[model samples]
Target: MTGAAPRLRSPPRNGGVRHSPETARKKSPPPPPSSSAGGIWESAHFLKWTAADALRLPVRHPIPCVLAASLLFFMAVEYTLRMIPATSQPFDLGFAATAALHRGLAASPRLNTLLAGLNTVFVGMQTMYILWTWVIEGRPRSTIAALFMFTCRGILGYATQLPLPQGFLGSGADFPVGNVGFFLFFSGHVAASVIASQDMKRLQRCHLARLFDTLNALQILRLLTTRGHYTIDLAAGLAAGVLFDSIAGEYQISHKLNH
Candidate 1:
């Protein structure tokens, strides 16, 4: 005891520097692991519900969210023009062609839906490009660009609705309810793409077939409730395909980017 040296304690002053084991133990908890991402995804998800609530997608993109809204607007407008059966004026050529072809697959509703979904994926990709290049590209308009694109499409759609063949796009065959149903499906896709691009990146390589499967079930639910139509199955199929593929594609892109 006589040989033991006095324990030296550092002087503490008003400089406010302090340390403690308890304080060390109480780390900031790593920011709660971000249960969800903010910014575009939050915007997309919110806008989706907002659009659904409004019953009209007016193609108004706030600055924070661009690509998804743009895709929805341009694709909806362009695809509407491209797909519906035509006289001389335009609807969607692909939609019309697909609709015509879909008649043959009426016997196999499931198969037809699969094909329609695949077609929708292509349309989505092309639509994205159009916005990236002509509408929003080189400019940072982002979501606003998409909103503007939608406005343009809306204008075009209204114009074509008048001059274009009223077969499906304009006709009751246009299926307002069916259109709304399809819009719901498409809305999920756009929202998923936005979220996936942001938050799901962390979960990407995680195999989301479960999520895809969930979406498939939802589609089936929608299908069962709706009146029977030749394109219904096809449209549902397209939505599922796009949903699954967007998840898959996003994972791939994220992997490439991360690596």
Candidate 2:
């Protein structure tokens, strides 16, 4: 009994289990790293290297840099140029392209008349092709695009009334009745042709699309020569056609999803 007093045991510290000093030291987290000048210099060097790399990229890809330079030049010109008077007609570089043709039209009414007739025929062709895509070919996207474009054109055209150009050649055979008066901010003819051409391309009718593109170029030249539309008008018309076609495709997609 009292021979060997029961061996005594120590209670666990800090919880159920006690760890040795060496184990505790190993389990503890390391101290935070000190912020050193070398680290700051390394970060600065990295940023500088990144910036230099980005700068060199434009050297290899010069088109974007050229465009940026051109933009800056134009901005400088715009800033330095005098404001045009309210009554004066602003000069247009696009008009310069057809300057001779414009003068020719002014001098020869017969030639103007003939060109007008041809333009009318082209208009008819665009109409027929557009309708054919919808009514005959069972593809309605082109027609829908034309409708959307015209609706938007009407709204914008009526909102701001641009005075007719000085030497516009009026034609009885034009799309508008007698070419007496119409919207001058956007060319429906060009927009319609674009719509039809885009539809042809989508349908893999490459030959027809190319034909339409060629005719569109000629139509653009004629419109510019006759002053049927302003340079901005034709440009906007092309953009509008592409925009409306995209809209039509989106609408068709949404409709299908809903169904």
**Per-prediction RMSD in angstroms?**
20.7, 6.5
Per-residue lDDT for 90-187 in model 1, tens only?
Answer: 43333454454434455556664554465355336434643453344442222333343334434543553332123322112222313343322223
- Measured by lDDT, the strongest candidate is 2
* Worst-scoring 10-residue span by lDDT in model 1: 168-177
lDDT of 2: 0.86
With a 3 Å backbone cut-off (N, CA, C), the pairs that clash in candidate 2 are none
lDDT of 2 at 225: 87
**Lowest summed lDDT window (length 10), candidate 2:** 43-52
Q: Each candidate's lDDT (Cα)?
A: 0.42, 0.86
